[model samples]
Target chain A: MSESRIERGIGLLLSLIQYVTASGSVTVQEAAAHFGVPEQRIREAVERVFMAGVPDGAGDFIRFDIDFDAFEQQDVISVTMRPAFEDETVRLSPREASALIAGLTLVAGYTEAAPERVAALRDKLRSAASQGADTVAVDTLAVPLAAQRIRDAIRDRSVLAIDYRKPGAGTQRRRIAPVALNLNEGQVFVEAADLDKQGMRTFRLDRIEAIEPTHDAWPYALPERERTVTGSAQVVATRAAAAMLRDYATSEPVSVDGERVRLDIEVWSEPAVLRAVAACGGDAEIVAPASLRRAMHRFAVDALGGPSGEREQTPRD
Target chain B: MNRVEAEERQFSLLLALVDTSVGFTKHELFVRVAGYQGQPVGDALERMFERDKDALREHGIVIDVVQPPGDDSNQEARYRVLDGVLGSPAELQFDAEERDLLDLALRVWHEGGLTEESQRAALKLRADPEFRGGLPLERTPGRTSDPDGAEPATASILQPRQRPRESAFQALKRAADRRREVVFDYLKPGERTPRSRTVQPWAAVLFRGRWMLVGHDLGAEDTRTFLMQRIVSPVKDRAAKQPFEAPGDAATTALAKLEEIWATASVGVHALPGSDADIRLRHRRDTSEEDGLLVVHHADRHLIADELTGFGSDVAVAWPAEQRELVRQRLERIRDAHAEATGEAAS
Candidate 1:
């Protein structure tokens, strides 16, 4: 797990103050007594000692000083970290990280586990990420597909024309009024009332060739207040494209100020509104109205450095 | 690992071993426990094997049946923990013998002394039942080192290198706990060894699996890592010394350079290593990783770099600029080293 700045700071303080080379430096019982913690807790606290040090001032190693020749003795840590094993690291521990990665690779070369724990593992990964622990890229055939769009449509009771392919059908075809999408294995299965079947059927999205609005809309409209938001991927894609262009902006959504999506994100581009617009990936309009867009166009022209210079043609959809 | 004692402590040890393994197979149970029985004991072993599961289950340990392979006909009966029971925690129930092991671990972590089978015996606790509230090790056991009843003879332990006397280790520990910078009247090991040198203590460590005292040698005006075993004599300094502080963990930032810890860097940029993504981080020696991380370090750089190449997308770069550069350079060198190492440009 990644450490928080405070946790690391505390560790730094402890390392500086309490990392004694005393023979009884860290006894679980003693630590528990001194810290007023349980055995489980103290062990957890003590395990941090394993990751307690930034090795060699470069912050490369999560090192613990041990008194054994790793090459000679096969301690648990040493065995797992035996110069040959490699695993994807979640945080900074090379042995565990490499061991895990190596293990997954070894496992991947063989079998697939039942589909479960995606969210839990992802949550663990997210927690580790929060603590600044980088997760090893684990390749699994069991991760659930992103079903945000389907979820939103379902939540809103909006009509969806899904291009779906049935297993062994050998091809994809269109359908109407999808209720939701559920993930089974790595692919998404759309749950919709099929007109032909007049019943609920699951269609794999990957098997689908396309998606479009049918000539018909929803049987009943969703109230505006009940609509859900889903655009992280889209926003991220936009930011990545901006970064590719060497100009970028990042924003945190502010109050949904009326119909406008007010954002208090940091901006660096001169045409601030355009950069903001670009960051939003067209989901955002210049709700501040003429002033925001006009200033952006002017800045775009200014960036081009002349009124007729024609650099204003920024590729925005 | 003995026969007579194994029979005497068989029930307790077996129960304990069950707690340790979380679960054990019948074959494994036979090999470990019956292997301890020794000599023409196969008949008795067969009896124990049949009754072993029932006996262990009586002691709140269950041998779980693992899932059979889809294609296999003969089901491999695997053992595991019973539901709602994670067995024991180590600190909870270490007996005197196990406590002795903990004591040894404590001493070495403290005094920097190594002894015969201490690491081995202590390692055994890993195979013991997780004890409940064994003993608090935070406070000193009152400056009194317990006498191990079954101490192995020194002759049994080959001297791999130099070993500091027990007295010296105890002294260093006492001084360090008091937060006093110790003046080592250190006698260096090997030919033409010097008798003594004064130094300001920063931290004492077990490194490369040997005790080392890190201190600023005032005369030399430099920090040095001194192996404890190499010191023939070490005395607390006469001069008033400042409190010794271990170097911030940043010292181990070099751990990423170790071969075994390289898989954490196995990421390829486009999120193509299946579903999980990888990122590179440089955790300095002081950067602590809590969530079940494994780290390794070696004096060899190339070995680590070479090992890092296989992680592919599962690993990330998380460290020293030079190490990252070395990884980058090593990837470049892969072109020249192995023919099959076709260039795979990863972002």
Candidate 2:
């Protein structure tokens, strides 16, 4: 085996030895499961490796005293004597501590997890870690109430009256039976059954203006989600815009010209495609499907025209 | 001479080190340790010893070296494991609750970047004498509900995961830990070209859902932050220069700077009531309503513009002439991209 690979195994082996020594006796099967290793590796590790200690006078050797009979017959490993390395504490390297601590900090930030307990746990990890673990940090945002409420509604199977705003439309009250929730790139999306629309729609949690539980329960058995691809469109993209389009593309993008790519994309909704095109900001254009291009033109024109109807525009702040 | 397995050799060396009181000289170790006993004592043997010592150091074990006075040329030295260099592991103990929290933390990064570190840490923690008895902590009530009825690895039902490990993140983090400077090509948003930056990385922070490297830009001669996503080239270590010490409070300082920017960069928008813009912006953290206008503060102006552009005709930029112009330009581009005869309409 390579030197580094063996070194990594040494860490595992050392930890395993310490565990065995501390526990006094454990089944090989139990040891294998605990370490997430197969039973054969565990048996080999004990029998072939870590069985020897320092050589003594006259070419003799001092070795760890294991119960050979019990180990061979009953698949049990009992370390009777450890000639050296007596300590049994689990030591975390600096990087190990950092990874764990960074993860804990992220969780503690987003949820109302017990603050005192997290703090106490963090301090313990810091104390246990080697030097240089504290250099990594993660920023936390406030707990989003909308996400919390939606999660509760999903669990209760309760019907909800939510005022949801589509991309270009005003908030419309809809009775929804929310099911699964997904988070991508810090945005929360909920898949729900829209009673009025009679189909499932994915609603951005942030776009939900207000959500209240209805007295009625979810009316039917849970339904499988609708197919994601309702339509397809072709677009020409500049290099920069291609990078952004790659994220939303349902299929592989093919290079068309120098610094440009042709992408055949699945369109989940008209509004979604328009927003993506707008985000690209002219670097990408809808090449075919004349209707989408027309919609894109109208989308921008209406946006530039500003708010219509009752509320008169306030002067620019 | 038979080649001994690396593990047995290392283990024997460790046992010898831990057993000796005064320590062993280089020649004595080669002549005595099981792995090197039959090998010829020479440069190759010495190099092998050095490599083993370095490997042990990676495991956080430091061997104490005792040198003879006035023997610099002779290279007379002795080595042994010290009492506490390997840490007083026997004294380390975690209660049941802490163990559960540790397990939860370890499971956060499933299989990338930090997974190896977290897994090794888990193995080490399982060695703790108290680890055997504790059942994994139960999920806290009310807030703990997984929508799919899948068992969550963490205590919280809301598993907001870290973004997939950034390509440049591990390099920058390793540099920060070792205090090494790194060089990479950074592509700033809206720029057509990338510029090479040599920076002394100090901290890696996850700020506002993005991985950012906070470091001192050697070229700019100032502390700067670079978004990891914008790094267009592989990060390579500048090995000629010696490593330098980083400030103890690098993370705290970087976070404070980001927070300050987020507090000051405010934009105003007029959204039709009950529209996507109105609802999302109003619910956004740190938003204020003034004269029926939604005022939002963010660290990046382009990000705000991009979000507003996504709302299409439902929202309009209301203030800060520069930001308003930026939104207007984006909208015009979108409109012109689909205007059919694009040349004259684009200009």
Candidate 3:
């Protein structure tokens, strides 16, 4: 077996022993599923465990009691005789601690609680791991108050009256039953049933100018069919820009043809797509969907005073 | 040796190490450890012992080697797995709610390279009775009603992509954590070749879906943020050098400096009053409507340009000649590609 597999198997063994001891007994199938391993692998790991012991000692070996009936018929794991040293505290490896620390720092960014509370929790985790106290540098993408209000409405099954700023269309007041808040690629989106439009739509949280929770409760159950907006765009970019796109793109690229990378993405709104293209500078261009391509040309022409140098009447005109 | 035998040997070695308090010499370990026993004491045994030590250490097992207290000669050292370093504290406890929160925190790495470590940690915690009574594996909770549900919404937001195992990110993180100096070849934006840089890493920060390492350059005598992806070569640690102290608020300071740089670069554009571009730009912080054009201030002009291009004809860039040119070129590229495709169809 590869070294990594063995290492992972060891970690699994340690965790399994601890789990079986604490939970009294667990089925082999459940253990396999929980550890994301095949049942046969778990069985092999367990069989190996039965052979482990101190050298040249008659009674100094680790022991386990397995029910033969459950093993043969039901595939249940009953550890009647637990390891003597099961109560030993397991310390996290340095790598494990670092991974957790990085993860917690990321979580602190999305948390709605006070910064101090999150910091304290992080400190506690560091102390538990016996690591030095250097504060992690995290870009706390603070959720807007409007987004928070929408989240609360989703939880309470209430309707939200929001002054939403839709791209190309300006601010409009609408009442909608907020269903779910999705976080895709560091952006927050609210999937709601638009009362006026009478269909499902997604609104970028940052574009929500103002939101007020109404007393009216949601009258309908969540729609069974998820409203997913998926599209693909092809673009040619510089190597540097391509790397950035690979990192920030919603999903993996569909194909890479020299400098051009075609991306299959789930877009929340049309403006979001424009925002992505804008971020790429001149390095990336959308190659498909004639409407989107024309939109790009128009956006450029409009920004440059309509291919004529004459000042446009308005930013959108 | 067979895979099972290798595992059995490792497990036996672990048991032997954990069972002892006084420590063991190489000779004693060869006899006491199940796998090493009955083997001839020679070059083969020594090599096997050395490899086993490294394998165990890689799994986060702490083994300590120290000379006997009264020993004068440089003889064989006694080795022991450090006590209390491999296990959780007995007094450390987590309530169900705290466990749920931890579950949420751990779930953030579901898509990243840290998923395995996070999963193991979660399983370790779940072994405790206090945290075991919660729901079985479920997806992140969509609403607050099921806070302890499968997946937390926050975790889904800002999904971190899995980084390469040998990425510069891991190296920089290690250096920052150890307060060590690192040297690497870095490629700045628009630069073709990479230049070597010696820096004292302070922190690794993620902003706008990209990882940046904040560090103090020794040669330049200035603090800078190096994009992780732009790092072209392996990050090498300077050995046998005194580590420098990281500034207390290094991360915050670096982020603020980046934000400051962005604030100074503004682009002027024209959009309809209620158009999507106008609404979104107006909603953005540090943006204002000036005269007949809206001036948008951003940290990264390229990123802003990409976003603006999506608006398509709905907005116009009025100022910042370079940004306007970038948009024009991008539009031209798209138009040319479409024309070529259409021409082929007509032919």
Best by lDDT: 2
Q: Whose lDDT is higher: candidate 2's or candidate 3's?
A: 2
Instruction: Provide a comma-separated list of chain B TM-scores, one per candidate.
Output: 0.29, 0.75, 0.60
Candidates' C-alpha lDDT: 0.34, 0.70, 0.62
Write down the lDDT that model 3 would get: 0.62
Q: Write the per-residue lDDT of candidate 2 for residues A117-165, one digit (tens) a residue.
A: 8888777777776665356676665657777777677666678999887
By summed lDDT, the worst window of 10 consecutive residues in model 1 chain B runs over B153-162
DockQ of each two-chain model: 0.02, 0.40, 0.33
TM-score versus the correct structure, for each prediction: 0.20, 0.79, 0.72
Roughly what TM-score does model 3 have, to 2 decimal places? Answer: 0.72
- Please give the range of 10 consecutive residues that has the lowest summed lDDT in model 2 chain B: B133-142
lDDT per residue as tens, model 2, B68-169:
887775456888875444555653567766665665566555443565566566667766645532112231212234455554333433433454446777
- Judged by DockQ, which candidate is best? 2
- TM-score between model 2 and native: 0.79
Query: lDDT at B107 for candidate 2?
Result: 52
Ranking by TM-score: 2, 3, 1
True contacts kept of 1: 0.00
| Residue B87 of model 1, lDDT score | 17
